[model samples]
Target: MEEEECLSHSSPSTDNSLELRLQRVTAENIKTVRILVSSIFPVSYSDKFYQECMNNELTGVVIRNGEAIAIVAVKPENFETGRVLYIRSFGVHPRHREAGLGSFLMDFVDEKGKLLKLPHAMLHVQTSNKTAIEFYKNRGFNVDCLVPQYYQRCSPPDAFIMRKPFH
Candidate 1:
């Protein structure tokens, strides 16, 4: 929560009717990001947990009017993969899925990784979430491995460790 600078990023909507604006996310934006993320994956956690995630993570969010409808969080070089940008969390509000928001944020992350000299983007997704798996696959991500019990807090706690490398 050092510098809370807001930026506007425009992307296409689901209907391709209007442009959706995105911006940098800080600790103050965690509440809305959490809500968006929880809508996709509900986990019991506190503000401190999310605050830590946003402390230095590269997070982008789409706010409509006054509410966040999408969010993507990333951690730089904090993984076993050297020079990798790990996608800690990503989600679009249930009501806003299929909109170009997810793709836009993902493209932003790719650009972000390259900017930081990181070429890999990694994330863990529950195996049960077929929609998400397909979404990642369509975006050029591939399953690198299976993380058993990765989602221990949830039922069917297995996850696929997916990774996409920048060219």
Candidate 2:
């Protein structure tokens, strides 16, 4: 089935409010995703990044009261270790932080990873982003290694490759 069709059939596990729903990214809502990303993260993404989000089944947004409040976009990639789910971008809007949206979106990713049998989930977190690092660690992820200058335009470009093995 098409990813968008799959999304239309499935329902959010916890959210029963009609005003709050999860939807897959599409050409129509891609703009909203970009705007939300810009507001939450300091980095700018490439055109290819946004394109992947619209085409991939693992990319999605949390809509609350007609606005995207969180996003989790991922892709499956072949690593030296094997197939892994790479989180390309993930963030909850600043206004929605500390309201459990981050954890909720993460749980959504974990479910997607398992459904795809990806075996592991990986993402990069800026070394200076202590909150994100702690959040990943709390979700059973470990700092796999430091990648110096991973980010080109961000301050303290260094990043840590965090991974969670959950086969």
Candidate 3:
């Protein structure tokens, strides 16, 4: 993916009042990213996980009115002539929901993965989060399987392994 061109778009919202800019971020943009994403997640991650995401190279931050309102972090790999793009975490600020920020990030992920020649993008979402499940399903992601106790720390413990084939 072209780092400089990664700002997918910055069009105005439905009413053309606010502009949402999707910018690709590196390890240096960690502070705001961590704060924005942390506020959206229902559960808190360990410092190590946050640190990894902060230090992760493949991450995007959505900015609105000069503040970050959404983020999507990823870990990508190429193996055996096939490429895989994994979504580490995706979250949009509660106040920013329904503004299509999440959709933008999801679409960005798909586009980025395909551009990177990754045939598939994968992720695990908590089973109890029906909203997230529906959001992903509407975007062509299918539940590959159920991971029992996938989140050892979360109360629900179960997760849905979702995948979207881009090739």
Candidate 4:
């Protein structure tokens, strides 16, 4: 795996920062998030798909300094009568990578899930995306299953379903 340079952005501040708040996706932020997705992932959906996510209340964004640097879309599922938060899409802007922003955003979700009594958090990642795989693993995610050709539409890559039990 090739190591990419860690990108950094101005740290989020409370005084001048544009309220780095987490809110249900709005029409304005949905467009911005779509662009973000397209930039990070090879395959991304149309504007309507983003709008659907916003309408479904599955999307979230972190606004900092009046810019959306991180975003995630979660799909809550009932598995064995226990609620699991499936991280559908998650990304931080390239310029914001390795700035503790990704961990901060994920920690925010994990804290929220714990407060809501969600048992575990789940997500899928391309097998060849070693950087992302290692990042999640370092954060304590363990692989539960593998899917072949999972990203056929996006890339010719296999996928791994990972989960972390939030005790």
Candidate 5:
């Protein structure tokens, strides 16, 4: 994505009042990203995870009104055939749901994958999270496999590896 491209969203009080933009994660916004992830997911991330976010070229946050309302952190991984974009963390703030922010971040991921010439994008989601499963499926992801007890502390603990192949 361009360094300063803006996404305009309409508001009840004013037309296109909310301005959103994708920005790289930095020391200044690291805490905000940690909080955003905690609020959206049931998992706790390590300091190393946040540290890696700062260095990953594909990691970014969606800032709206100068606050981070969404995030998509990704990295490349080698599977059996080739390297794939591994979506480490991706979510929009609960309050911002259904506003197309999720899709916006996803489109960003797709563009990055194509630019990098990755064969596929993959992520794991809790099997119980039907909403997320449906969302990924709608974006052309399929369950590659079931990982039992993928999460140590989460109830049901199982996860499904969802993958979207780039054609």
Candidate 6:
């Protein structure tokens, strides 16, 4: 991730035209979200995984402009016997990034997790993805653990599992 100059933070209401809406993802949007994921990650979306997201067993959000511009998927997990949410895929369109959209989506997820009473929100980031690591860390995520050779096919960086506790 490139270290571009930080943009000014804007209030949610200030960017009403560039709305960030969170809804239960449907089958139709899964493909588009998959495209979004593929654009950011090295993994390809499998048919079964897309189906699971559309089935509502997994939670997702679509940030759109009459079409999916960005998407996030979370799988609920039982951590420490408490409900936890792991962000499975999160990506903003390359064209729309650096305009506060990522932060908006993240804020939306944080609110949703709080409402769901999740103990913490977790995600894994490649060590080479400095921009994503900085973004999460700035949003209160702490590096919880490191896994070696996590994405062996794509890059040679260790995986950093970061988590942000809600309570």
Better by lDDT, candidate 6 or 2: 2
- Residue by residue across 12-70, what tens digits does model 2's lDDT show? 43434543345788876777788898898889988988887775668878866556788
TM-score for each predicted model, relative to the true structure: 0.83, 0.86, 0.80, 0.77, 0.87, 0.79
lDDT of 6 by residue, 20-122 (tens): 4555566556556766777777767677777776646245455354456666677777765366788877877787778777787777667668778888999
Cα lDDT of model 3 by residue, 40-156, tens digit: 776676777666654334667776554678888777865443568988879888888887888878876877787777788888899999999999999989998998988867879
What's the best-to-worst order under lDDT? Answer: 5, 2, 1, 3, 6, 4
Per-residue lDDT tens digits for candidate 1, residues 14-131, read 6666676666666566666667767767555566657765644376677775567887777775666666888877888888888677888888788778878888888889888899
Give each prediction's root-mean-square deviation over alpha carbons.
Answer: 3.3, 3.5, 4.3, 8.0, 4.4, 7.6
Q: Residue-wise lDDT of candidate 5 within 46-116, one digit each (tens)?
A: 88888888845688787655567798888889877578999999998998888778887887788788988
Name the better of 4 and 6 by TM-score.
6
What lDDT tens digits, residue by residue, belong to model 4 across residues 1-167? 22212222223533454434455566555556666788887766666667666745456666544466787677677765367987877888898787666776676657656766888898879888888888899988998899788876756568998999888
**If both were scored by TM-score, which would come out higher, candidate 1 or candidate 4?**
1
Which one is best on lDDT?
A: 5
- The Cα local distance difference test for each model comes to 0.75, 0.80, 0.75, 0.70, 0.81, 0.70
What range of 10 consecutive residues in model 5 has the weakest lDDT sum? 6-15
Clash-forming residue pairs, model 4 = none
- Model 3 residue 167 CA deviation (Å) reads 3.2
**Candidate 5 segments exceeding 4 Å error:** 1-15
Clash pairs, candidate 1, are none
* Pairs that clash in candidate 3: none
Residue 71 displacement (Å), model 3: 0.3
